[model samples]
Target: MAEQQKEMSFLGHLEELRWHLVRSVAAIFILAITFFAFAEQVYDHFLLAHIKPDFITYQLFCDAFQLFGIDSAFCNVSFADKKLQSIKVTSQLMNSIWSSLILGLIVSFPYLLWEIWRFVAPGLTAHEIKKSKGFIFIASFLFFIGVLFSFYVIAPISIHFLYNYQITDAIENSFTLESHIGLVTNMLLGVSILFELPVLIYFLTKIGLITPEFLKKYRKHALVVVLILAAIITPPDVASQVIVAIPILILYEIGISVSRRVIKKQEKNANKS
Candidate 1:
């Protein structure tokens, strides 16, 4: 009887998990369709905005330099006649569908996390639950911040360098729809996932897998790695590399702090038990 009951219980849990997965996916699809409906606006306003010289980031930098009595040739760029083109008729249609899906996933991230939390909460103890009470919110907040950072900071730097780059006066820079969308989505998702370092550290510390000391001891090595990653993601210029690397290193330090707090909480929970 005990064995049979355990099997039934296992199946029940699996069924519940399946439902959660279904609902989360359903939400993503629904949101994706909604975005696809307004695909033209999304492409023009959000996805391709960074390519425009008068986009807010470029404008803000131009204004800042002027206000501070600095002169930069980059500020006087002409955005006209610079547009991404699709070589094939199918490319535009395909990218529109995929880009909408990506945006849908990002916008629905908080809800997706909530669904994950709901599924995982049942397996945790009261102490564990309390300790991780803010996990979803903190994780979602960092993810969105990373998305914004990539969109506003990294994307602009990359677009500025790439769009303006030319081999010679005879050559022109014509970007394909695929290449443009690929770069944007890659940066957006990559940085957003990287920003979960603190949450990752907290969980690792809770499980007694990593410590603050370990992270601190390897800090220099981590800096090198961060710079390498920044170089890969952003423009090859030192200025762009430094801008992207700074926030990541800050997040690593924050991860160390989170690890320390997780240790303290684990010790307290041990004492209570």
Candidate 2:
């Protein structure tokens, strides 16, 4: 009887998980439809805004340079010679659909995480569930922060630098629309995942796969990797790479702290047990 009950419980959990997944997918579809409806405005005002010379970042930097009595590239109002191209007739339509889906996923991330948590919560011990009560909020906050960083700091700088770079006078710097969108999407998604470092470390530490000591020991290596990652995600310029790297390094340090806290909490729980 006990074995039969256990099997039934397992099946029930799976059923619940299926429902959660269905709901999450529905949410995504709804948000995607909304994004698709406003695709033009999204592309013009949000995605392609960086291409304009009078973009907010450029204007702010230009003002700062003037105040400091410096001749900055931000003071210049034009890209050297670069244009986005679409080689196929279906490219624009395909990009619009895919980009709307990505936007939908991003906008619905919090609810998706909530559904995941709801599905997993029943399997966790009451104490464990309580400890993770703020999981959805923290994860969503970090993810959005990463998204903003990628959009405002990483994307604009990278676009400006790459669009302006000239290897030779003969070669034109025309990029494909697919290439530009791919770059932006990758950076945003990558950084958002990266920002979950602290949460990941917390869970790993809880399961004894990570430790504060281990993180500290490999800090230098991690810094190098972070710098390389920043360079990959941002522009080739030193300033751009450094700007992107700083927050990431800070996140790494925060992960270490989170690991320590998790270790301490586990130790306390064990003692109580």
Candidate 3:
């Protein structure tokens, strides 16, 4: 048994990971089927809610602007006249299916992470596993926060900008079903993954792959990268980019602190051993 364990190859690990992925994918599909049953309701009430102008985010921003007697576009924004087109016969159907899958992934994210944890935890020492046990909750929390931020903040800005961007009065903005859903889903997934920075740093620190000093040393570079990411993910506006970058920068700082704590703990553990 000892020899068999010691002789485990890369293929063995890959096989194990494959099973974990299969399980995770199965969970997502099950959830997707559930969402698919209410596809129309999900599409209108949840996915397309941001484009309604009466979304909670829009209202709050409008009220905030009004309270201070400031003029803002959100104050007069209206999406009642807006419409989504389906050029292809199958576009609407495909979008509904894809959107359901994305929603499934989001809804089952915690379970997905739990599946990942089960795969990886066995490779770590008991102490390490115990220390990192909160990985699922923390990761899920960050992911949800990112999803909410993207939906309420980034999605609104992008939708507003694109919907109102008129080159000429003759040209009408007719967004396609695919394009609309694409933007929202991309933003949701991208930010959700980005928000897992601290969790990522903790793992890297545990494995001696990174240190707080290295993060500090490359802080400026990380800022540039974060800003670039913010620009790519958000609408082309300084305010929007800044808004997106602030939280990411803060996450990076928190990641550094997490790294420091991890390193300190490892050193203390080694000394005790």
lDDT of 1: 0.87
lDDT tens per residue, model 3, 217-258 = 999999999999988877676776787888899999999999
- 230 in model 2: Cα distance from truth in Å? 3.0
Cα lDDT tens digits, model 1, 36-98, are: 999989988999888777888887778889998999655886758787788997998899899
Report clash pairs, candidate 3: none
Off by over 4 Å in 1: none
Using alpha carbons, what is the TM-score of model 2?
0.92
What TM value does model 1 have? Answer: 0.93
Per residue, candidate 2 scores C-alpha lDDT tens digits across 130-206 of 97889999999999999998888788878878788888989877788898887888777877877888888888888
- Candidate of highest TM-score: 1
lDDT of each: 0.87, 0.86, 0.88
